[model samples]
Target: MMNDKSLDIETAEGNAQPPHLNFESSFPSENTQVQTNTSEQRSAYQWYVVIICMVAYILSFVDRQILSLMIEPIKQDLMLSDTQFSLLQGLAFSLFYAFMGVPIAALADKKSRIKIISAGIAFWSLATAACGLSKNFIQMFLARLGVGAGEAALSPAFYSIVADLFPKDKLGRALGVYAIGAFIGSGLAFLIGGYVIGLLKDVNFVVLPVIGEIKTWQLTFMIVGLPGVLLALLMILTVREPERKGLKVGEDGQIVKASFKNSVAFIKTHKKTFFCHFIGFSFYTMMLYSLLGWAPAFYMRNHGLDASQTGYILGIIILVANTAGALFCGWLIDFFSKRGYSDAAIRTGMIGCAALIIPSVLFTQVENMQLSFALIFVAMFFSTFPIPASAAATQMLTPNQLRAQVSAKFLLTSNLIALGIGTTAVALITDKYFENTVMVGNSISIVNAIAGVLGVFLLYKGCQYYRDSMKTENLSKS
Candidate 1:
């Protein structure tokens, strides 16, 4: 039998009325406080779990980002417009990815997170391979949707697991290490995608056993996607679920699993902080996804570079610049935390938002290609700080039972506004306002400037709200 404490609160009004929580006096739990010991050093096993999780993250991004590098060919093969291609890259994946995260994360909060993550890796990997089988726009869109739905299961659970594994002092660095997978995967997607495109640019088609002939791009998807299945199996077999920490307990000494509604209630209590966090990060990511989605097209159209060359260059930049940035940002958050800054994560995010703007906009506006690349390198470096910072911010503030759900809420808002709207916005501007494919560079600059400015202003305000919210909660970190 499972622990009774994990049961949802049983009240006359059901979940609509959350169990009484008095943060002003103490944490919401009836008796027990959070169980994690901040002084304990993380073990070797914990590091292993983090490494496996990072590998899974790497594969997820590879599947998601590879499509960006194949835009021209996919459009040519499927007779798609720029807007239609953007839908496949942005909306089709993000719509389901964002919407599905809540229910999956709810399960993460209550069930075995290890199993959830493994299953997700398997599902998305297969979904990615399925994208290779698509022969039409509708088919591709559906495939992308499947990929999104499957990937929706990852980050929230990973964040929850990592939060349980490490102390608050070390949480940012651990998560920052995990965040490296995103850029690594993105880099690999471009590098491998570019290499494959170059290798097979001459080969028209190849015959499969039962499936008949397939395009080179189709083969590439299958190659990248199928390996994740084995990785999923490895995760299921090797990784053990970490103990849930900082959970609420009732008067009878049973842990209380916060209902979805309870999670919402907690969020409502700290609405200002969440509002700034969700919107600010969403806009920051809007700039990021826009650049990632369209940069290949920009280089190909404006700079007279082919797919392979652009991919190689961009891949190197992401691997070096973005990876370093993520690690530094993680360390930076931990540094701020150690120095008695309650708003460390938000403060770090504000710095990145402010620093990245000039370079982000100027990179595209510049004439010299090498100078443009240098600016891109600087922008890319600052762009990564928010990834770890945002996760650290949420994990530090929320109680254990509600961590995954709250993180999911942030993902839903961030992905929708960033990936869905932000990416599509660029395509719309290029297709309608500019009415010229070569003007995509301008579209990137405009979107970057608008999003960057908003991110800085909101995060600036968020620091104050975060500090206010911290005062109310009895966080372990404090």
Candidate 2:
């Protein structure tokens, strides 16, 4: 392994190279060390950081997803329409979550990612607890915004950290492990949230110390949200930031400090690639969020199940199907990468999207519960492909300084479309077009069909664009 002095010299030597120099010739020794380290495999501490990051991600999703299972009770208590509830689920959270990521990720690029992530985990956990204290639509909306803002700090920073920790060969699996946290957390939210709802089913309200009387759903938020604070502390104490790799250099032989503007300029240099990646993955996530945010309600209303029952079933499906899919997709990306596919990430995404279309649209259209669930399992399995794919695509091509900012940009586009538009699009169609509440399944099917088709087409194009972008980075074999 390269020591700190050798690493500094490596960066300095690269900076000493001329502008427009061939990338492969600019850092021969660094490239050799990279190849050597790939064979050395990752250390125990590297895996430890990945595991801790995964835990944080798990908590983040649990807090975010628990609200889906509580739709009926929350709507009843707050006197909200489907549109209003959709705003809480989609617009209110996503608006801040998406936009805030850019600025927070800029900080992550320059600052200590571990600290940034720790602060974010602590803040979001508290915000999630605050969701329990919400008395009305506006209050819940505000609390959800806080949750979004806090969570905006996590992924961009985590992606940057993980990329620095692992080589390209092992990056997909590490990120895949982290991505599975989304499913694990969502699963727990549903499974445990269901069990809690069942326990609190007979009781309408709970009396807490000083807080007095509150709905059981409110208590559920508090239950799942608070443990994250401790996790944040654990991270702060244990995980040290890894050395930044693949940094860009200025003509003056100094490391280039990244800003949002620099990040955007870099994207413009590979405009077609990012356009396909950002927009394509946005459509994919549109299908994903629509399903995740509404599937519980689909089971409840369309399939004649209650909240607890819907939670239990969907939770199990999400846990089993989505988690496995994330892991398998990560390995699949590595599988393709090992075979010299420069567009492995996007290629994997296209495969998953193609397989996802029928299952996503048909799952809700089916009348039989077993058939619907089986289809849902398949849809969910493919839905997760973007998790590792998106991360790997961004990290693989971006400079270390700009990785977080670029990731934040992708998050902005993705969440805006997926959460803000996707979730609300379903509600709008159901309320205005269908003119019925119980026809949510139809709305789900329509959105998934449209989004899935667009997602596949764009990703298919993305494979070529991604390959071209890799060539631009001088990382492609072709």
Quick one: best lDDT, which candidate?
Answer: 2
Candidate 1 backbone collisions, by pair: 5-254, 5-255
Model 2 segments beyond 4 Å from truth?
Answer: 1-42, 250-253
CA displacement after TM-score superposition, residue 141 of candidate 2 (Å): 0.3
Q: How many clashes (backbone N, Cα, C below 3 Å) per candidate?
A: 2, 0
Q: Model 2 Cα displacement at 271 (Å)?
A: 0.6
CA lDDT scores, all candidates in order? 0.91, 0.93
Query: Model 1, range 1-478, lDDT digits (tens) per residue?
Result: 5455545434424665455754556544533333233223347778888899999999999999999999988999999999999999999999999999999999999999999999999999999999999999999999999999999999999999999999888998998999999999999999999999999999988899998899999999988899999999999999988888888665589876667998898889899999999999999988888778898999899899999999999999999999999999999999999988889999999998899899989988888999989999998899888789999999999989989999999999999999999999999999999999899999999999999999999999999999989887855244
Q: 1-478, model 2: which lDDT tens digit per residue?
A: 9999998777877886654577876566877999778756658789899999999999999999999999999999999999999999999899989999999999999999999999999999999999999999999999999999999999999999999888888888998999999999999999989999999999989999999999999999999999999999999999888899999886699977788888988999999999999999999989889889999998898878998898899999999999999999899989888889989889998899889999999998878899999999999999999889999999999999999999999999999999999999999999999999999999999999999889999999989989988997888966
**Model 1 — which ten-residue stretch has the worst lDDT?**
32-41
C-alpha TM-scores of all predictions = 0.90, 0.91
Q: Which stretches of candidate 1 lie over 4 Å from their true place?
A: 1-42, 249-255, 476-478
